[model samples]
Target: MNSFFHDENVALYRKLIAENESNPSRDEDRHAMLLTLLAEETAKAKQLPRLPDAW
Candidate 1:
């Protein structure tokens, strides 16, 4: 994979850690935003196509 893809994934991972550490549940808005982000990520993962010839 290219550096850009790897960078983006790393950035997303950092953001998730930050979000969790910040205790978003204390604030309704932040909690909702986190949920939205998680839902979007889940949807994107589900949309990825499977390879034609996997081992």
Candidate 2:
């Protein structure tokens, strides 16, 4: 997968989490699910190859 997509997904997950927390009637289950997904996605993103500064 492309790093760009991974970054986008991470950003989206963060946004969703924020929204869920602020919601008056948020589902705990959904919040947990989103947090889990965000952690997994962040791990995957970190595993992606990094380009050298010269690049």
Candidate 3:
């Protein structure tokens, strides 16, 4: 529940959003990046044991 983790997640989420928005046609590169970000977030969430209250 720290600002650092919150900021990091927000940044990642923003990147995903930007990537998606930049390519509304579902480009392969965009999809792959989104999936990679999702997987990374999932792994981080799982490894954290407990998610931040703010998240």
Candidate 4:
């Protein structure tokens, strides 16, 4: 694998933290966003080709 392919996931982690926030004041919105993000990630993963064991 190349280093370029392992770019930092700063945006992804930030979104995950924001979605997982439990301030009670935004529970509904947060849960909805979480579900949307989960679906998006799943779709993206499904579209990628499988890698060999060496990876």
Which number leads on lDDT?
A: 2
- Model 4 quality (TM-score): 0.49
TM-score of 3: 0.47
How do the candidates rank by lDDT, highest first? Answer: 2, 3, 1, 4
- lDDT, candidate 2, 1-55, per-residue tens: 3787999999999999999999999999999999999999999999999666575
Q: Which residue pairs clash in candidate 4?
A: none
Candidate that scores best on TM-score: 2
lDDT of 2 at 22: 100
Model 4, position 55, has a per-residue lDDT of 56
What would the per-residue lDDT of candidate 1 be over residues 5-54, giving only the tens digit for each residue?
54465568558657766874566666567667656665565566644455
lDDT of each: 0.60, 0.94, 0.68, 0.55
- Per-residue accuracy of model 4 over 1-55 as CA lDDT, tens digit each: 2322222233464466565674546667666766676566555555656666675
Query: How much does candidate 1 score in TM-score?
Result: 0.46
**Clash count, one per candidate:** 0, 0, 0, 0
Off by over 4 Å in 4: 1-26
* Consecutive 10-residue window with the lowest summed lDDT within model 1: 1-10
When summed lDDT is taken over every stretch of 10 residues in candidate 3, the lowest stretch is 46-55
Clashing pairs in 3: none
* lDDT tens readout by residue for model 3, 1-55: 5445745875787777677778758677766777777677656765655655774
